[model samples]
Target: MRMIVMIIFLVLLGLLAILNRHFLTYPHTLNLGFAEYKDMPVGLMLLAASLIPMLVFYFWASVTKLRAQADTAKLLRDMESLRTSLDSQEGSRFQQLQAHLDRQFAEMQTQALPSSGSASEVASLAAKMDAMKRDLDLQLDQMDDYLKRKLG
Candidate 1:
């Protein structure tokens, strides 16, 4: 929207310049290191001078826009790559944690379920199993919360 308004304003300015072309009347001349010119109008000269800066501004704007687009594209690609890497890493880590948890539970079962011939021994073993289960649940809940925060 801003670009459209700017373009409209530039067109009006150019029209104004063209309409005021007769502001210069006397003969005018210009010379350069490599060339020479004569009979140039002051109004026309003013218009050309104004157009030179506008042209330069347009070229600079285009170059800057292209650079910005390239940067954005590069950033998007990097983001996608990072996302995929994180996903793969997350899956592998979850699997590793699950396997580790299963091993720990199996070890706990083998140690807790045996040699419970007496009532007191059975009670102690039951208490130990409950503590291990609570610990495992706490760790799992912490892991879940960490993953939710990280992913979000």
Candidate 2:
């Protein structure tokens, strides 16, 4: 949109200059505190003065946009690295929890087997634990998927 506006402005300026060619070319004297100029095309000088700033601003805007893009790219890369680190940490924690649960199940099986009533109770508890673990795993998977979708 800015580019289109700039183009339109340039076209209009060109048309104006073309329409007033004789006036733009007409020479006049210019005076400054320190120096004086003779036979200067003041209209053309004014036109060039206006154009120089516009050109400078356009290039400055372009450079600023490029810098912003580079910064964004760097931030994205940092985020990706952080996500990867967190995923590895989560995986290690999951493995540790599984190991702890397995050890506890083993201890429970050995101690509960000696009594018949407690054996049945242990089986029921094991079933419940398995169901809970499955639910927890499903929830974690859903959360990971949600995070991936949002970030990517």
Candidate 3:
């Protein structure tokens, strides 16, 4: 879009210059504080002055756009790295929790097999596991919400 606009502006400026060729080429005097320029094509000089700034601005905008794209790409790479690290950490934590739960169940089975209250003990353990599951799910949901908020 910017390119199109720039091209149109250049074409219009070219047409105007072409239509006013005689005026643009006509000689005149230019004065500065310390020097004077005689027989100068003042119109052409003004045209060059206008074009220089426009060209500088166009290049500046292109460089700024490229910098912005590079920054966005860097941000996405950082986000992806962070997400992968978080996933790995979560996986390790889950593995640790599973190991702990397995150990606890093994201990419970060994102790309960010789007791009469084994059924009640199993039910209590099941309830505790269910509670832990709910807590884990809540934590996961909170983490998900946090990630969504950050990304958005």
Candidate 4:
């Protein structure tokens, strides 16, 4: 496809250049403060005028393309680093939460347990432990929901 377009453009350019041949031999001159060109062809003069800007634009486009690609690569690297840090932070938060839950369960056992020898006291302590276990389960479910919401 690209070659076809280029070929078509070349044919058009050949026609244009040929059509301009009558003007090509027309005498022209260009002068600078320190240098001078005399009896240059009109075609050569026209070619120079058109070519300089195209060269400039090509270089400018190439530079900008490279800069944009470099910036995109840097952005991707920064995002990957940020993602890893966030994952570590999330892991630490979960570990801390689990440790805290363990401590709470230990405290419930040590503090709510009755020293009485009565069966009633034992039963009451058992019920309290069961409730604490359910509370822990509820907290875990809430944490799972929070993570899903955050990630999704």
lDDT of 3 by residue, 17-114 (tens): 99999999999999987999999999999999999988998999999999999999899779978887998898899889989988988888787877
Clashes of each: 0, 0, 0, 0
lDDT of each: 0.72, 0.91, 0.89, 0.70
Local accuracy of candidate 2 as per-residue lDDT tens digits, 74-101: 9888887898899899989989999999
List per-candidate RMSD values in Å.
6.6, 3.1, 4.8, 7.8
Best by TM-score: 2
Residue lDDT tens for model 1, 1-152:
44676698789987886676567444577766687778867666766778788778777888899899999879777766786677679768877976886787667667666555654565676678678867977886787677556644
Ranking by lDDT: 2, 3, 1, 4
What does candidate 4's lDDT look like per residue over 1-152, in tens digits? 44465567557766877888778767788677798888878675676576577567667877888899999879777766776687679778867976886787667656655655444565676677679767977886786677556544
Worst 10 residues of 4 by lDDT: 113-122
The TM-score of predicted model 1 comes to: 0.56
TM-score of each: 0.56, 0.74, 0.63, 0.53
lDDT score for residue 56 of model 3: 93
**Clashes in model 3: which pairs?**
none
* Cα-lDDT of candidate 1: 0.72
